[model samples]
Target: MKALVTVMPKAGVLDPQGKAIGHALSSLGFAGVADVRAGKVIELELAETDPAKAKAAAEEMARKLLANTVIESFRVEVV
Candidate 1:
């Protein structure tokens, strides 16, 4: 099975990296672009064959180690 985990900053969190990217984009003439939020995706290979089990495992990993629950949220997908 394969699992994909996406981690992103929650709404209302200060995202300096995202801000910098937005600024850079505007400087590069990409105008009217706003509210750019940055995030990451992680792919994992697992032995579990069931999609439900794989997803559950990935979600647990996100809650325990992949994301900071106070500032970020994560989504898990199994394939």
Candidate 2:
């Protein structure tokens, strides 16, 4: 089984790295960029094949180590 984990900042949190990237893009001649936010995508291969089990385990992983629940939110997709 393959799992994709996406971790993103909470709506109200400020993303400095994202802001920096936006500024860099504008400097390089990209226009009309209003805002930018950054997030992380993690791909994992799992031995489990059942979708329910994979989803449960992925959620656990996100809660335990993959994401910070206080400042970030995550979604898990199994393929």
Candidate 3:
């Protein structure tokens, strides 16, 4: 099985990197941009064959180490 993990900062958290990217986009002539959020994607290959198991394992991994639970949120997609 293949899993994709997306980690992003929770709402209300200050995102300096996202702000910088938004500013740069406006400066580069992409106008009307209101906000931007930066996040990371992780791809994983697992031996589990069931989609449910793969998703559960990936979510556990995110909770344990992949994401900082206090300030960040994670979504897992099993493929």
Candidate topping lDDT: 3
Error of 1 at 68 (Å): 0.6
**Candidate 3, pairs of clashing residues:** none
Score each candidate by Cα lDDT: 0.93, 0.93, 0.96
Candidate 3 Cα deviation (angstroms), residue 8: 0.8
lDDT of 1 by residue, 1-79 (tens): 9999999999999999999999999989998896799989999999999899889999999999999999999999887
Which regions of candidate 2 fall more than 4 Å away from where they truly are? none
lDDT of 2 by residue, 1-79 (tens): 9889899999999999999999999999999999999999888889999988998899899999999999999999998
50-73 per-residue lDDT for model 3 (tens digits): 999999999999999999989999
Order of quality (lDDT): 3, 2, 1
TM-score for candidate 2, residues paired by index:
0.96
lDDT of the structure predicted as candidate 2: 0.93
Worst 10 residues of 1 by lDDT: 26-35
Q: How many pairs of residues collide in model 2? A: 0
